[model samples]
Target: MNIQELLVTGTRLLKEKEIPTPRLDSEVLLANRLSKDRVYFLSHGDERVLPEVERSFLQDIQRRSRLEPVAYITGKKEFMGLELEVDPHVLIPRPDTEILVEAAMDMLKEKTGFVHVLDIGTGSGAIAISLTRYLPQVKVTAVDIDPHALKTAKKNADKMGVADRIQFVWSDCFQNVEGIFDAIVSNPPYIDREEMKGLDANVVEFEPVKALYGGEDGLDFYREIARQAPGHLKKGGSSSLRSGVPRPRRSEGSWKKSVLDP
Candidate 1:
């Protein structure tokens, strides 16, 4: 089938399967299968897809229909303008998390010389890598509870050319972390236990559970991070946390609770 026909059929099939973002998913998957960018779809929609290429594209769509994240199928997610490699072992970084990254950037604007950040529960190292990308003099020590997740983060750091600036630590929150930091950033799991059942299948079924659930109240990671961060942070150091909370309410309430105690 030709490019236009293939995208049309794929979009229809995904829509029928109740996949959200069907058209976008179809376009991305088809473009990836053809070893082209999404622009290729718009520019060459009428070009014929090879029989073998079509088969591969269809298989990717089937995985998406089964509720697997498109990022998992594509094996890459663009975060903070950097493409990060992701797998089932680590949580895919989201756009909401970018808020915390920007907050940290703003906090560090006036600081200089040997700045450090401690990224607790650093999954794919998106925050740490992005920070190093923007701040040439900053050092980031990224900690993760899961060794596999640390491996994934290191891979991403290398891919983004920030491997030298990031120190990957295997720790449960702050357990093994060392030194004080100018800032601490985290996007820890904050989904409540009961709320897990209500998440869309793309997340509940495919994303890592350890990276999604945060105990019955959804405050476990926040509590733990706040409890331990004080010892690892420099005096007056800041904490930038990203979660499900709305930005304003979080800055006024939950975030204050999580950081003050530390």
Candidate 2:
């Protein structure tokens, strides 16, 4: 079938399956399969898709019909304007987490000399690598409990040309980490256990559970970060916890404010 006809059928199928942004998602998946840009598909609607390419597109459509995320199928997601490889091993980077990156950049820009940053639960290395890319002089130490996630993050860092600036470590939280950092930023797992049951099957069943669950109250990781961050953060430096109100916890030593995500 021609591009236009395939897109129409795909959209209808996606909508019937209750997939959000049916038309857009269908086009993107098709464009990726064709190894062409979305605009190319739009401008060449009359062009015919080869038999093999058409079969691939149909397969993707079947997956989408099951509410699977397009990023997982394509094996990539764009973050901070950089394409990063993604899979079931790591949580797909979200736009909300971009706020964390912006907050980190602001703090890093004000400091002079060497600045060290640590990204806890550095899935896909999106947070750590993006910070390193923006702050060339800054050194980043990213830690993840999962070795598979670290492997994926390293690959993304290498692809984004910031592999040298960032260090990937396999550690559960701050157990194996050393050295002080000017800033410690993390978009750690904050979703409560009960909330897990309500999440879409594609996310709850497919995405990494370790990267999503934050324990009973959804504050386990935050509590750990608060307790250990003072030892790692440089004197007067900041550590932003991406969560709600500040939970009461003992401060380690010197760090400044610990702002919560609003």
Among the numbered candidates, top TM-score falls to: 1
Clashing pairs in 1: none
Measured by lDDT, the strongest candidate is 1
Provide the lDDT at 64 for model 2.
83
**146-214, model 2: which lDDT tens digit per residue?**
899999999999998999989899889999999998899998887777787788888987799888888
Kindly report the root-mean-square deviation of model 1 from the true structure over all alpha carbons. 2.0
Point out where model 2 deviates above 4 Å. Answer: 244-262
Q: lDDT per model, in order?
A: 0.87, 0.85
Q: In candidate 2, list every pair of residues with a backbone clash.
A: none
TM-score of 1: 0.94
- Let me know the TM-score candidate 2 reaches against the reference structure: 0.92
lDDT of 1 at 107: 90
